[model samples]
Target: MYKDVNNGELRKGDVGKSITVAGWVSRRRDHGNLIFIDLRDRSGLLQVVFNPKISSSAHKNAQMLRGEWVIQVSGDVVQRIKGSENPDLPTGDIELSADKLVVISRSKTPPFEVDDDLNIDDLTRLKYRFIDLRRPKMQALLKLRHDVTRTIWNYLSNQGFIQVETPILIKSTPEGARDYLVPSRLHKGQFYALPQSPQQLKQMLMVSGVERYFQIAHCFRDEDLRADRQPEHTQLDLEMSFVHQEDVVNLVEALFSTIVKEVRPTNSLSEPFIRISYDEAMERFGTDKPDVRFGLELNSITDIVSNLGINVFNKTLESGGTIRSLVLPGCGYFVRKQTDELIELAKSNGGKGLVFISIDNEINSIEKLSYENYRSPIKKLLSVEAVKSISNVTNAKPGDLIVIVADDYKVANNVLSNLRTEMGKRLKLYDTSEFSFVWVDNFPLFEWDDKESAWSAMHHVFSAPKQEDLEYLETDPGKVRAELYDLVCNGHEIGSGSIRIHDRRTQTRVFNVIGYTKKDIDERFRHLLDAFDYGAPPHGGMGLGLDRLIMILGGEDNIREVIAFPKTQAASDPLFDAPSFLGKSQIDELGILFKPTD
Candidate 1:
């Protein structure tokens, strides 16, 4: 090891003791007779001073140091001057007085600076991820991720959960997302798909009587990318035998609560996470993953809007659609431009437009009281009674702006859901001081697939239907709910799972409901069904997206910030330049060909 002392390990107790530190030079300053260099390692940064009288050669070498130059220095720990101390740093009170310096590796000028809170282009940062990880902020993020994961491992291990490793190469199964298939070189025309979540293998563990199993598993999905998603990601996959839905939920809730309190003491998590049905969550927050930290709950004003005699509202009602709205307090003073911008926002989200009713009592109010009157672009289309009903339904106040969307059920909720988040951000309504975990329970088993002209699993085909709803599986499949649950925090779905269909008969029925023929089921899932023949325990579990959880805990908007080597939104690795072309011979070995469209 080149380093005997980490830069962050220096303290007042070590004063006057010589130590060797190895790291990259973060910053350099020359004061003629004396030079100061900030040396950074993965641990942290420490200031190193070089005096010509101490060692002329070392002082000269220090003067040559520039940003991000790798070097090792032997120095004595000394207290920094009280006036020059950096209060923000943990080792602010100590500095290294160098007597020897060695340049291990010198670096050219970097494409971007290595520091905290840089606003560098994402592509540039990703292209030079190696240097990017050298930043203190990135280091701290990765460290936090490691610590959180460690906490989970310790907690689960103490609870008799055996850590297990599942296969990376798995057979392709329909699981909502496209699969990234790996072509087999030896087995001609055959391929293995990367495991999406270890969903089935973990169940297999339960059937083999592992009792409790856990793994930090890698999952792949050949799908469109988003800020929080990637083609390949990681999850904390857990499973238990003879456990019901409540057992799984309680275990995960307790485990994650412990992780948050231990790994991130700066933030507090609410005790006893609240659980609500999926329908209730959507009804209240316009999303199944409700952020209960703030109250911008969605309201059904379609009943009120339908009676207003407005062409838009009546037309939507006649078409079996609905209306929804939310109230933002003290936003009635918003100017026309601000309201128009919101309209465009809604339109972009597939709504016809946004209806903003500004109840600015100062300028427009008769009684200077609740729903006295309102100033809005569509005020002419609304009667006084209709306006009063809207205000009452949405609980709009004198200074509140009522945002209404009239469209199909899904569209209205989707538009208002996005608007709610945007408004929360604009009003600074999020309480970031604590984590608010919620359990959204019992999602519908299947959703209509217009393109496929069939029903598709809402969670997955493996999820067991609620026992009471089993009778409605074939007749009222859309109404049949699964024994599924999602763990959400700060408006992000952190984890999800369900009771698995263990028996072959029930599994076959579920596959049938999802429009899969017996041949289709046998071809894809026969391995799992065969395992159940001997004996399968009542098993279920959830997989939490480790990257997403880490990103949230690190207070980052993008998961890539916490990930050391992450792909860009385009699903490309800028650093490695992956997804490159394969040689013709290699392609021929797989017996594949590329064709161009005319």
Candidate 2:
């Protein structure tokens, strides 16, 4: 055996015991005669010492070792002298006295050092991912992901869920994102798409009477990428038959709470996550997924600012736009440069402009405030009555900064949401270690797709509309609400789910509203539609983003930190050089042709 004990397993108790350990050189230092090396493995790091007095040959071989050289050492563990032990390391109390050394492998200088705190570019780290994963932080994240998956499996299995392995290749269907298609070499002009979420298959399991089904699913998409997205990702996909939206939500809430208790004991999580309607969330926070830890809630001053004669506000109201404001406490002293920067921020987020009114000194009442107490670009345009009404509505006080945006409803809300998030960070308004989870519910069943001049399902076509609103499917599709809900944490939507349409009639209605013709429905979802005929039970579930969940748990801002080998933001794999052009011979076998490009 190459190793009898791991590098980090040795301690003061194991002193005077002989053992063999294998690891890579983490650090090496040569003091005149004696040499010291920090050996690292999956467990942790251990300090190994080579002395000429103990073994001349081992001491000679250790001199040649450099960073990241893999080797095996037969050694006796000895306690480090008092005050010489490293308090930061777990195995620092004992040192390995090498009697023999064998160089198993050697490594060339890496593109970047395997250090957790090192600042390395994304491309460089990804191109050499093998070395990148050697860092302690990366290793811990990999372990955390594994632990999360294991916990999910155990919890679901205990709840009577059958772990089913769904097919990787599936029939192409419109599941929101674009599909990653693979050519079928044996069948010309045919291609198989990677499953986006096992969405349809899991529902089929209900038809087969599985009752409860789960899978750690690998999903693919050809969509644009971001810090939280990748070309391919994994999800905790689960579906339960004979369930309502509440049933799914309760199960998931319990499962996640248990995981947090067992895995992240230090972080605080609120029990019985706060629930808010989609409309209310947007009205108060200007976002469906809001970070509820802070209180920069958006307030509309559209009515109060009407006829105020500020050109921007007056024109916005005339065009059916709204005026929204966010009050930042104690930011009344902002200078012109700072306020200009904020205006730029608002413009960047699609707002026409930003207006700031700061109250510089303490005032007993809004009526008492005049030009002396206010600082604003349009202070001269607003009458005392109008300004007082705005202050009363927004609850603006002395030493507060009122930032307003006059634009379309969507743009105004969106711009204020971005500014609220930024200011929350600047003010340290919330504890970073706290996980605030909320359920954003009551999303519209369908949204108007102006670009396509048609209606599109807001979440997906399969989502069941509220029974009371189902009558509007034909007459007023926009008025229908679905049983859709999103699980948000720390301002990110980590999971989404809804009660699904299990019958062909309701499913067809949704499909029709989304501009799908009979032929298109038959060609796309005929298999799923047919399955509903054979006693398909009502089912609903969620595909929890495993990557995003772990990212939040691990306190990482990017999902890539939790993923072992994630593609770049541009959706290209730097390590494998994926999305490359296909070889001519391979393309020929697949019966494919390419158009020449300039």
Candidate 3:
């Protein structure tokens, strides 16, 4: 048997070459007189022909070959008879004239097909991920993910960034999300938490004179799942000394732009991405991470709608609420059911209800509601002046639909933002290949925590407050903006970072603002606090979610597709059946006990 005949190296001119190929049977076609098997390896696919006239013994064995069977074949490469060519396959012009065949291993019927076009449940595919990896699409995604990682590593290394390892078992500090804690056997009742990111460590490396540091870090967070979120994921964590927020941002932008050009040349990126302030993004798009690819921007109509005497609007304004509207071009054709569905979606995001007006009808006043016979229930509540004001504010024209939300500013904006995304999807308003990247700066240093009745760090306690806002930190922490920035692409927050607090006084003050007492701060972060005693350099960095970044690059919805052995939504690994029970002896050694409940 030939030892090596990969799919890519085959050519029609190599007809006289003797070859050996080992692969899984992609497909098996049996004619009465002849048998053909499509063999597939990671590289690609090759066709093998078994003619009984040439070798009856080989033909008999080939007849038993089923889909996905592991086999080895010794063959003579030959050009296919002109009519027998398969124009679809890469190696279609030639076929393997088999002399011998050996079944290396047999496979049972798979739970699902391993072909690229098969539609199967994700659970089933994840359960049998090994087989799923054999599919062309999955294989390509994994390879692409590898290439992306390699390119990033090479680029960073060339740029003098040193890859450093950070500890996985770290002391947990408050960071907005629940940490995945690891039980410490030696310390009885004490635990070490898995890092949500290498936020502190990378900064410490800079403090220790590492100058520049980066790690393709694995982070764990005990959080609920979403399409882009996972309990355990990876990030390209990096930090640099002697830099400001702009320096870090420029470095990241250059890296990503280079990656895009190298990995996905077909996709285009705007030169020098647009910059948007957090307030401006929220004002125009109703979201801080606005997808700038589309133009259905949100507009305020509080003054016009509040004076119209519409109960929803007047009540909202009376209660210190705001009214905002988004005009969907050509959405006036939506039926009653679609509008009702949109209202429900908005309500779920904390809105009271959605009030929509179809501008397609020419009737201009509440009194002419019966004349135009609009589909919305609020048609009779608005005055002619209010209608005209709304149209002018939103630039609404014939065949336009204006969806308005009246609630507290935060609630109204959030609800309308989500609804805008939904409408974009339903109406096919977004371009899949379009990447609209922007920097979201001026993030609030601390957000008011209603539950705790205190101020909490919006990004983290170590993030530096902007110099302009530093004066307000002691007086009004709520109004202070941090030197934090988020890399947002097409409405997805891909990465976040900030200028770190290098001075001990500022750092301690930040903790105090978050209601951390001196004792509590020392107890939780004594090492970090102590490290700052030495002369620490000014440094800053960002962590990009590798899984989410790959998902975006590959145009995949789920992060699992880009991850090789990703856990399900429940945070369970089906392949290894991890998080399994340990034996009593092992548990006893760790001094652990589970109280079984009746």
Model 3 spans with C-alpha error above 4 angstroms:
361-376
| Clash count, one per candidate | 0, 0, 1
Best by TM-score: 2
Query: Can you give the TM-score per candidate against the true fold?
Result: 0.96, 0.97, 0.96
Indicate the worst ten consecutive residues by lDDT in candidate 3. Answer: 365-374
Give me candidate 3's TM-score against the actual structure. Answer: 0.96
- CA lDDT, every prediction? 0.87, 0.91, 0.86
Candidate 2 local lDDT, residue 113: 85
CA displacement after TM-score superposition, residue 12 of candidate 3 (Å): 2.8
Off by over 4 Å in 1: 81-88, 363-372
Whichever of 1 and 2 has more TM-score, that candidate is 2
Stretches off by above 4 angstroms in model 2 are 362-368
Tens-place lDDT digits, model 2, residues 87-191: 999999999999999999999987888899999999999999999999999999999999899999999999999999999988888658899998898889999
In model 1, how large is the Cα lDDT of residue 217?
Answer: 90
RMSD of each: 2.0, 1.5, 2.4
